[model samples]
Target: MIEFKNLVKRFGTRTVLNGLNLEIREGEIIFVLGTSGTGKSVLLKNIVGLLKPDEGEIWIDGEEVSQFTEDQYFPIRKKCGMVFQHPALFDSLTIYENVAFGLRRHFQLSEDEIKARVGKALNLVHIQGVEEKRPAQISYGMQKRVSLARTIALQPKILLFDEPTTGLDPVTTTAVNQLIQDLSKKLRTTSIVVSHDMNCALSIADRIVVLDKGQIVALGTPDELKRSTHPLVKDFLEEVLHA
Candidate 1:
């Protein structure tokens, strides 16, 4: 339910997104794969209206949002929930407070409603019994789960994940990948995950989009990508397989 048409973003002499044309279907999990500096995160930012495109348009739910002002973009932003590479949780706030932060800012709800939503969000991420603890008191994986919980609590229509499995052990990476898959299936939230992790993409993607030099190099199912002959796609897959 999102479409990008001839999208372009430039910073000085460097062009990050060059005529990007993509369509993300509703309830589909798309994994964007690329090396560093390939505009994967830029794509996410553009989709969320954090960074505006220099040319072309971005459409969400059939509405063009490229020219929307901050006031007009507020509701669109709320419909999207982003999970950064880092959890970005507040060290000073307890887990429950952190998860409740957005809900409090955006909506006026009774304490009981807030508690139930927070509890359900945590359960969705398979996190439990840490509501009273601070972020520092939890493991890195748990902290990531809390970050996800906070986002899911908003009941967003779109979920943007940037490097969701970064900086974790293999076991935790597996857990996080599985969590992404589970959440996408259960929530049906049009998830777009930006990651270079081949295993993660293969494990979770309904389709994989490969970016290179500010452009889409390939887009296909995991099996199709595995059989691709494009030089860049082949090289990238080889590197991931060997690394």
Candidate 2:
């Protein structure tokens, strides 16, 4: 489980997160939803030590992530995986090498082990037989799946997704959302996804957290979110419903 306690982040004069408190349970799919610039991505970064909060702590599986040094944070980071807003694959590397990159860099695994792991990860995401292709050679949706495959290659206990369905068409978006749900259930990984896509959120989230102006304005299941009386949440849902 991940816990955010009084977390705060600021950039000079601007405060991006304001004493945010959240608890993400183990083996659950959590969706952090909000309008643009509400610090959802920043919160995910803090959980994995990519960004240090200005105040308070981020606890992952009972360990305080904020206290870990760069070297110490490595092992902890290894236990966690991330899928960025953009498919941040190395364009120069082939799909197999890219997916196996983490295993090669971090583990002392043999060539056969790396090959097996990479192949299994790709197969998990239903993107087999693309190992020789470069990132630029695949479609955007395919690239996203490859990125997801790379993330799962680490066999992480926790998976952090930053806007997983951002730029895809509705059908492709649905495919990614279903993959997220399937992966979380199959692997029992604690999945925390930050997204503005309400459909994706409603589809995969066990719980939804709505952030507005650096604070959690609402937190509930999809049904609860739809039934919420809070004007901010209702307004957001109404807009999505109309759109």
Candidate 3:
């Protein structure tokens, strides 16, 4: 469903992605694993057109989006939804409003339609009865669920999660991971998750892509990654396991 061909991105003198090539199939849950500053999030942004590549191509569902103009990119973007490390909820807006925000911007739906979709999304994330509360009124974990609901409400064909389990307690982290797994299966969306959380990656990924510096160094199933002999991959596994 997504392909990156010789993708390169640089910031002034620094290169973040160097000839990165990858293909993500439909209904697959892909986890991008790497240390900090390894361009995992940069890759996600490129896929959704938030950051245009300095060189190479980005194709989504068979169309090259690398050279798409902003107006041209709009519809392409609508096929995808992103959740940041920080939930970034509008504090003034109620949970209902927050989830409904994207729908309001992108579609002409009635109050009843919006409410039904928002409720369904919240339900998909196992959240309920907090529709009237502001973001600040909820626990941080709930805030993350709200963020996921917001994205799910858009009915996107693809979901990009940047550290979905970050900044949560262990139990909450597990909850978030399960939610990602469940939603991916339930929604059957092609999902790409950018995370350094090894446990989360292991539990949720159908395939794992390991990045080092600015390029892909490994790609495998969880079992294959566990049995990997590559130095960087072994070191990463050892570090996370011992942490």
Q: What is the C-alpha local distance difference test score of each model?
A: 0.93, 0.90, 0.93
Backbone clash total for model 3 is 0
Give a tens-digit lDDT track for model 2, residues 1-243.
Answer: 899999999989889899999988899999998888889998888878888999998888878888789998988898899999889999999999999998988899999999999989999999978899899999999999999999999999999999988889989999999999999999999999998877778777999999988999899899999988877788778877887
Query: What's the candidate order when arranged by decreasing lDDT?
Result: 1, 3, 2
Candidate 3: where is the Cα deviation over 4 Å?
A: none
For residue 139, model 3's alpha carbon misses the true position, in angstroms, by 0.2
Off by over 4 Å in 1: none
- How large is the C-alpha RMSD of every model relative to the true structure? 0.9, 1.1, 1.0
The residue-by-residue lDDT of candidate 1 on 97-199, one tens digit each, is 9999999999999999999999999999999899999999999999999999999999999999999889999999999889988998899899999998877
TM-score versus the correct structure, for each prediction: 0.98, 0.97, 0.97
Ranking 2 against 3 by lDDT, winner? 3
Model 3 lDDT vs. the true structure?
0.93
Candidate 3 per-residue lDDT, tens place, 1-243, comes to 999999999999999999999999999999999989999999999988889999999989889999999999999999999999999999999999999999999999999999999999999998999999999999999999999999999999999999888889999999998888899899999999998877777887999999998998899899999998888788878876897
Q: Best candidate, lDDT-wise? A: 1
Q: List the residue pairs that clash in candidate 1.
A: none
